[model samples]
Target: MCAMKYGLLFFVTLMATNLVSEADGDLMSMIDYRYFRCVMKREWKCPDSEINFFMYTPEHPRKHFIDPRYPKLLHDFGWDPMRKNVLIIHGFNGTYSKSPMTFIRDAYLSRKDYNVFMVDWSELTRFPCYLSALSNMKKAAQCTAQLYSAITQAGALAKMITCVGHSLGAHICGMISNHLTEKQYKIVGLDPGRPLVSAYGSRQFRLGRDDAHVVHVLHTNAGFLGESGLVGHADFCFNGGQKQPGCKGHIMRIARCSHFMSSCYFAASVRRSRRLVGIPCDTSCPKERGYWGINPQRRAVVLGDDVPDGSRGMFCISFENTEDCPFD
Candidate 1:
């Protein structure tokens, strides 16, 4: 009887093991699809903690970049009969065609007053701040080119335009300023993450007065950069920084999977431009107080091919942008 019981337990264990193996196989396949490109893989690793270890080092954009998930974001946005211009950008690990962006799409669609557009960049996950700042510089230039083409095509005539970015998307906000024409602009950067400043120091990157008129950076983490120093984005602030009053943590937040309902805040603010949305600004930090990095002249972060020769980006190459680029 004892031997029979032992044999029965062993049989059950083997069956369980087989089932787990099958489940793991399914998971692994999904992983392949999920981490489709370097940009997605890298930027998604969040909270900047040791726990977020790099699963695989992604190949550069020129390498194995694949399909851009944000199709609507890249579309030529020309309103019927024309309206004001508005460009919306996504941050790290974000796709304009995906989740939060879906909410964004709906938000803009609801408001017919603005000629809505989106900037689908090189995968945000692929370029670290240091690398992204440099490589994305040109991509930024090209995207702005596209936006202008879009603006021209739509034939929209308005006083000024506005650009909104989230986290990594905020970096694109800076990039647009660097590459585009100097227009009276309104850039709202929500929870702009520190552009993955490298070991040497933080990069001197910011949306200059040249890009947008009043560029506001709403900060969440009170790390190195205080309330000042963010050039281009003249209005540097915080979402009350860290744990603010109105936010209701992860699950309960308005929409999407983001820890904070950042997009909702972004949309709310975008809807009510010119007027203060009152979305919690950290006025506590003394104004005009921002710490500088090591080499201010050269941005502290290197990006794209400029991602320091030695430094390897976190995600591996899955495909190339040219292979799947939905461009003319």
Candidate 2:
């Protein structure tokens, strides 16, 4: 088991190191990595991760999964068609019960009367074998699309549905949006994973700006787990999207803590409480000017899942490392 795990890790390590190797002054193409990917794909055969959806409402705070096949399951569960729906997708090794996921879910439920559903695919996204989990994201997204389809057919409004994903789960939501012919109301990517994904430009595998009618990305750990590229209509970076506040000591601890802050900041944003403010810009702002500076006039977009539309391009907001309040 150790050998198998390390073997997979070796391939990932090699590809990551040589992400942009040069041959005769020419950038070596992705074909070089394809061989190892093929081997992993064929040998592993990609796990068909089951996508589970749990719905929550103010009346009944307990999370429950409603089967779309029954159509009436949602109605029976006290789902209000009038209320807008938001589906939450968790990242690698995450589940419905986890911190960021549950925190974000409860935060939304605490303030709004919207239908909140948490999408769990933790079985396939177990830790240590991220390669397998990354490949399985597509299958999981397809399953989610089918599930969403069923739900919408059952009287849920597709036009009113908003899907939010954190880490690799963000990419999964992107894939789900890509798979469906109809664009979802909105897709919010909270720090989309960078490793094994940042190198690729394929719209099929990675999230893109056009995946949904309105795609917003919050980069709390950008250039690390979060892709640094501007891949959304509005990409908001809090504290430059790395080395987040309250994450101190040790490299790994800092990275992990900062990476997860995207969700925490987002959860707080839903209630519009002490939200990090961003200023709109016709063109992208210089890195030094935004996020790092505490200019209220420069505020672009409020940090969270509920950003109002109108502005485009990247935005930034600053906060101290010890400050729990986003902009304070």
Candidate 3:
């Protein structure tokens, strides 16, 4: 009987393994199609703690590197102190080399003579270790805050600096903004990562609404990678902040689709002049189901790079699968 039971168990395990292996290709292709080139490799080794900054300007619109050690490196990089500065922070398991990060930098460089900085902390954010990456986020935020201070002390205006962070990177921006005394430096959090941040409610570690002068959060994958609760001055939920339009198939793709849409919409907003129309709702309203309401008296506002000053409160936004111009 023992021999028979052992053989049966081995057979069951083999079958399960074979099934998973067979479906692996389909799952990966679906994920790639919806995520727009995501690398889901398992990186077990701990990455080094290093932050890289890629700067881009109108004069040298291509791309340039800046050392955080030398605060005056901006001058050598030909940074324009007059133009607005945008610092983009990528999420867990992501680097500045990723399409979203580069796309954002290019979009800003193409639109105006703004100084776009890409913050790469991939060393500490390797894949399959999201918990480790979440813990290291505080360190990343500390490094970023130091860099921000150094840059301001050298020449750049603190008010002109706008930090844009996606997923876990968004929370890092919030932590950085919290440490900075300058209240005018806005933070645009693109679907701040939900899992670990919400699990630990300690205010010292999580991103709050008043972390910056104006904390604007865009929730595209709430309850998944994004925190469902409103954690910003203005929280905009796109497509009810759950399953997005473009993503279908596997469960993983569904979760990632909306989470990534936050960055996609923000990137598109940089080059496109047309803004999205958002409908306002009561504070007690459910954000995930915000689209099925009727409140015409409330004025609609843009939710991205073109958002006007003093656009406060929560709102619901809808967009087409391809772009933000077309509303649902």
For all candidates in order, the CA lDDT equals: 0.38, 0.69, 0.69
On residues 1-328, what C-alpha lDDT tens digit does candidate 1 reach at each position? 9999977754543332222111113323433433333331233321222111010011111111111222233222223433455566665434555555445545555565554555555343332222333334345434454455444444444344566666546655655555445553566665554423222223435444445555555443333221223333223233333333343334222111222234544443444421322222222321233421112233222111112222211111111111110100
Model 1 residue runs over 4 Å out of place are 1-78, 122-134, 158-160, 195-204, 208-210, 222-239, 244-260, 271-328
Alpha-carbon shift of residue 241 in model 1 (angstroms): 1.0
If scored against the real structure, what TM-score would every candidate get? Answer: 0.50, 0.80, 0.79
Model 3 scores a C-alpha lDDT of 0.69
For all the candidates, what are their Cα RMSDs to the real structure? 17.8, 8.1, 7.8
Give the least accurate 10-residue stretch of model 2, judged by summed lDDT.
18-27
Compared with the true structure, model 2 gives a TM-score of 0.80
lDDT of 3 by residue, 183-288 (tens): 5368888888776567764675766776776788888888766878578877787777777787665776566666777787777777775476667754422353
* Angstrom error at residue 240, model 1: 2.7
**Alpha-carbon runs more than 4 Å astray in model 3:** 1-49, 284-294, 323-328
Give the lDDT of residue 308 in candidate 1.
29
TM-score-based ranking = 2, 3, 1
In model 1, state the lDDT of residue 304.
15
